[model samples]
Target: MAEWVPVFRGEELPPGLMRVVTIGDQRILVANVEGTFYAIGAVCTHTEGYLDEGYIEDRTVVCPIHFSRFSLISGEVVEGPAEEPEPTYPVEVRNGIVYVQR
Candidate 1:
C-alpha cells in the first residue's frame, strides 16, 4: 500500500488556491476548492510546464505553455496539445490537515 504524507494544512490553502510540493522525487500540485483538497501531477504532460503556475478556472487547470486545460478533480485533459491525462493522487483530510497518497 502507498503511504500518505502530509503535504499541507487545510488552513494553509484557501479556496481557489494551489500549492506545489515535492515528496521525495515526486512533484505534486495540491489545490483547495472550497475547503476540499485535490492532488494532481505538477508537471504538464505536453512540455513539462509547471501546472502550479497555470491558472485555475472552474475546476480546470490550464497549462501556461500551450494553453492545455486539465480537470483538477479527474486529471482528464479537457483540452490539449497534451495527449495523456495527468496522474492524480488520492487525498485525505485529517485534523484539518491534507495528506496525499503517494
Candidate 2:
C-alpha cells in the first residue's frame, strides 16, 4: 500500500486555495474546495507548468503556462493544451490534518 503523508492541517488550507507538497521525488498539488481536499500531480502535462502557481476556479485548476485547465477532484483534463490527464492522489482528513497518498 502507498504511504499516506501528512500535507496540511485542515485549517491551513481553506476553501478555494492550494499548496504544493513534495513527497519523495513527486510534487503534488493539494487543493481545497469548500471543505474537501483533493490532490494531483503538480506539473502540467502540456508544458511543464507548475500547477501550484495556477489558480483554482471552483474545483478546476487553470494551468499557468498555457491555461490548460484540470479538474482538481478527478485529475482529468477539463480543458487542454494538455492531452494527458494528471494523476490523482487519494486524500483524507484525520484529526484535523490532511493526508495524501504517496
Tell how far residue 66 is off in model 2, in angstroms: 0.6
lDDT of 2 by residue, 1-102 (tens): 799999779999889899999999999999999988999999999999999898999789999989999999889999978999999999999999999998
lDDT of 2 at 31: 92
- For residue 74, what is the lDDT in candidate 1? 96
lDDT of candidate 1 at residue 33, scale 0 to 100: 80
Specify the poorest-scoring 10-residue window by lDDT in model 2: 1-10
TM-score of each: 0.96, 0.96
Best by lDDT: 2
Candidate 1 global TM-score: 0.96
Q: lDDT of model 1 at residue 77? A: 96
Model 1, position 51: C-alpha lDDT score: 92
